[model samples]
Target: MAKTFKYIILGGGVSAGYAAREFAKQGVKPGELAIISKEAVAPYERPALSKAYLFPECKFVMLLCLLSILGFFISVEFSIKIKISACLARLLNIFTLMSQLDFAAPARLPGFHVCVGSGGERLLPEWYTEKGIELILSTEIVKVDLAAKSLISAGGETFSYQILIVATGSTVIRLTDFGVEGADAKNIFYLREVDDADKLYEAIKAKKNGKAVVVGGGYIGLELSAVLKLNNIDVTMVYPEPWCMPRLFTAGIAEFYEEYYKNKGVNIIKGTVAVGFTSNSDGEVKEVKLKDGRVLEADIVVVGVGGRPQTALVKGQVEEEKGGIKTDAFFKTNLSDVYAVGDVATFPLKLYGELRRVEHVDHSRKSAEQAVKAIKAAEEGRTVEEYDYLPYFYSRSFDLSWQFYGDNVGDTVLFGDNNPASSKPKFGTYWIKDGKVVGVFLEGGTPEENQAIAKVAKVQPPVADVDQLAKEGLSFASKI
Candidate 1:
């Protein structure tokens, strides 16, 4: 059967969820919009996968909260509340408050749904139902016939749309791709989706306190290393880069983190790559062999090498640039009634005056929203403003949190107290390009200070003296 919608989102990911929300805001009628997702659940805050999803403690705590809530309701039904002493009453009140707080912490399905990642209201499955939006879960689109404006699902279902959104996002690159020996062995994992996080959780339990080798120096590796250490698993991280997050972090910024990780008992091996792995009789990863002729014992191995854009479905049919689908400022592709957004869309970065693709959650959201707005505006024979995205990226691990804004190019200046051993450490960096501050990175900054840096990045205040600018540090941003 060929089901049809006015608009069909090809992939139900973070971008898909945000796009759906924007469509609703612009007034979507029932049967007008459909989202096809391979995932069993609605779109969720994906960053949680590397952060809280791997930790099973959240699920455990939620169970306790549910039990407490159920008991409270049962007691109320039995009229037991009236007979409680003042001290017992106080205890019950405290329990209620704690349960409420615990209920909010679990990064489970409904708790970390769309819009919640940006601090908006959590859009539950029922929210989609109430909005009259069709959410086709667990249905992967296997074939895309853009010429016919139709898509074929793995289950042989046909979905036709008047307008199509190509938002398949990216697929994780596994070590197996490079023919790394024993990469397919059991207990070797990659964290991308919710299921991957669940598998990691199971491995963490099965190999409690066992050794884990994290391959990759990206955010995923950093986050996994921290969480695995918290679970008492001996973690060793191996990467080819001299510093962690080389794509974004300067040497000084990376130094602070590398030292902090070492302080937290994490063994970091740099300038080396995993050559192969050795598995036990049970086909589980037993050790990791590095290019340096070093062998490290491992019960669980997480590979976060990188990912490739999920653009195969529309390959050769759309314009391509910078390894992603080419799109304009409003995320519109060359084809009529078709648009691309999220990590797959390499749109013009207005702030930089260049074409670039960003694989961050913040851009994913803004791009999705901008595409929807442009679509709606086009229908009304009107036009919308171009997307002027201010690059924003942030990461959280242990007691550390950092935010980066603007471009990370040109001469870099590291400032502030970046001493990893300080009782209270706070630091920042500025990227000066053509004599102007093009980027700012701040760690452990107050909310106001973070906003100040953001403004500085946007305005790009000129800096003549690098040394004096470093001396001024965050104060320069605050004045801006």
Candidate 2:
């Protein structure tokens, strides 16, 4: 028997989660929409896996004994007993590090589900059930017939849809794709989903205090290395870039992070890459051979080179651009009732007047919502505004965090006190194009400061003096 849905989302990822929410908001009837995903669980906040999810789990309960007027409270930290006055005043000062074993626990399932990532409602499985959206988990769609408006699963099941959303997302690029020797050996990991995150977590436990070699200097590499180091494991990071995060980070910006990671005892071997791997009798990886003829011993290897958009399903059925399905501002493809959003959509970047495929969580959420809103508006013979996105990128490692907005083109002026060794390092960089501030990057920025930078990017006010802007640093952004 062939099942059918009025609206069918092809992938159950971050974009799919957001799209489902938008569909419900637009008054979708029960049993009218379905989300098909290979993951066993509902979509979650994927970024958490590399950061909070990999950190240690902390469990603690507190009974605050205080009055409303006194403004004093005591936590379960009574174990670190001291004078009443001292305990009350010195709490935050002494809270230093909380060892990840105390205080709040690490992120886990249900803690970081989708929608919450964008400060919206947490779309749990129950929420989907209430909305009557089918979560076809653990089912891989092996075949697609766009003209027939149908999808076939590996299990020999067929699903038909009137309006189709191709949100299959991106697949992790592994070393095996390049035919690196021993790439398929055990203990070599590439993370892109909840299952991959779980596998890496288990490896961290099984190889406690073991040596780990992180390949690639990108998001997953930097984050996974920090997680391993936090677990008291020895970490060595290898990348071919002149510095870490060469894609978006300036040399000066990369310098600060490289220094910070080194300060944390992370061995960074830049200008090199893993050429091959060697496994032991049990097929557990033991050593990673680099292109520079350097062989480093490693109990496990984590690769985070990059990802390729999964656009094969709609290969011959749609127009493509920038290696993704081509779409207009409304995320509509050449075919009617078919749309593409998230990492797989190469829609017009209205800000830049060009097509772009952003591979980040922020874009995924916004694009999905825009597509749904456009769909609903069309049904009512209304029109929605084109998606106007402000490029936003962020990452956290150890106690360091950074946020960047807008395009990274033109000349950049680095400013502020960027001393990585300082107790509180604050710094920013501005991209000047045609005497205008087109982009901004800030580390250790507060909420107000981050919003200021985002505004600066969006507005792109003119700058008369590059020197003055550098000297003013974040203040320039605030003024704009």
Candidate 3:
């Protein structure tokens, strides 16, 4: 017999959690919605994996207690006092509480995850049960019939739905995908899910004081470099780009991080990539061969090249653009009663006037909420406005963090103190298009300052004097 649902969310992730919450708010009755996920647990906030989850001191109870106190203070004093929002305030509180308790210890299965970084309470397995929201965990859907509005599981179970939300998210890109020989050698890792993080953490412990080669210059590469280094491993980073984070950082900004990493005892090998791997008799990676014909010994290799959308299930069944499932402002696909969100959805950027696929956590949460609101409104014979999103991306490593908003197109103006040796160490960049500030990036931004930059990017006010704008720097954003 085929089970049926009025609503079905196809992935367990940040988007799925938010969608579930929105559905509940919209009065989804018992048995009306089901969330099918391959993960053993419900959705959780994924960003913590690369950040606080890898901290070495996270294992100490005293340190965790201190972190909890600190997190609580910050959540109540800063987050709540700023009137951020009830949801954001709760998220901040939970983040701090969990960081001290859950993340302070080595992440245990089903124990350390935080659900919905913002908004409501963490959705535990019991929460789903109490809400009567079916959670089909650890189940893989083998096939989908879009026209028939049904999906088939690997175990021969059939599920039908009146509406489908494709929140499949993304899959990590493996080195083997690029034809790197011996890429599957043991101790070579890629981080995406909880399992991957656990494996990497275990490998680091097993191979302490060993050599590590991180292949990639993006967020994953940079973050893992710090993580491995913190684990007392000798770290070397390799990337084809001349500078790290080339997609976002200008050469000037890259110079600061490059120097900072070098100061932290990290060997940066830019303008090259790993082409092959040498393994021992145990099928364990021992060395990495570079494109320049150089071999470097490696006890472990971590690749963070990037990820591709997990859209293989619907690639041909639905229209795709920009390497993802295509959607409109409401996150609706061309097919009726079908939609997409999170990393898999390439929707129109109403703010930028083009279609874009954002892979950040913020967009994942916002898009899912938007889609649910639109769906519920339609069901109630009402209409919701189209999504108007301002692009945002952020990353954190070591003692530094940054945030970016809006499109990174057109000319750029670097400003503020970029010197890695500076005491305060605040810097920013502005992307100008047609004499207007279209993008903003800031390192070491306070809450108010980050908001200012976001506002500047959103309004895209004119910048008549590029030189003056650079001179004003953070002041320009403040004044605006």
On lDDT, the candidate that comes out on top is 1
Q: Which candidate gets the maximum TM-score versus the true structure?
A: 2
Model 3 poorest 10 in a row by lDDT: 107-116
Question: lDDT value for candidate 2?
Answer: 0.89
RMSD of 3: 9.4
The lDDT of each candidate is 0.90, 0.89, 0.88
lDDT of 3 by residue, 1-480 (tens): 999999999998889888998888888899999999998878888886776566664446566666766665676676634555764775667567665553444445454344536655777878788888999999999899998999999999999999999999999989888788999899999887777887888888888799999999999989889878877899999999989999888888789899988988999999998989999999999999999998999999999999999998887999999999999899999987999999999999999789999999999999999999999998889999999999899888877888999888899999988788776689999999999999999999998999999999999999989999989999999988
Ranking by TM-score: 2, 1, 3
Q: Which stretches of candidate 2 lie over 4 Å from their true place?
A: 58-102
Clash count, candidate 1 = 0
Displacement of the residue 78 alpha carbon in candidate 3, Å:
47
TM-score list, all predictions: 0.91, 0.92, 0.89
> Residue 72 lDDT in model 1?
61
In the range 1-480, model 1's lDDT, one tens digit per residue, is 899999998888899999989999999898899999999999998999988776535566666666877876666667754555744684578587775653434267778999999888888999899999999999988899888989998889999999988888889998888899999999999987888888888889888879999999998999999989977899999999999999999999999999999999999999999999989999999999999999999999999989888999999888999999999999989998789999999999998899999999899888999999999999999999999999999999878999999999999998899999987789999999999999999999999999999999999999989999989999999999
What is candidate 2's TM-score against the reference? 0.92
Where does the lowest 10-residue lDDT sum fall in candidate 1?
Answer: 99-108
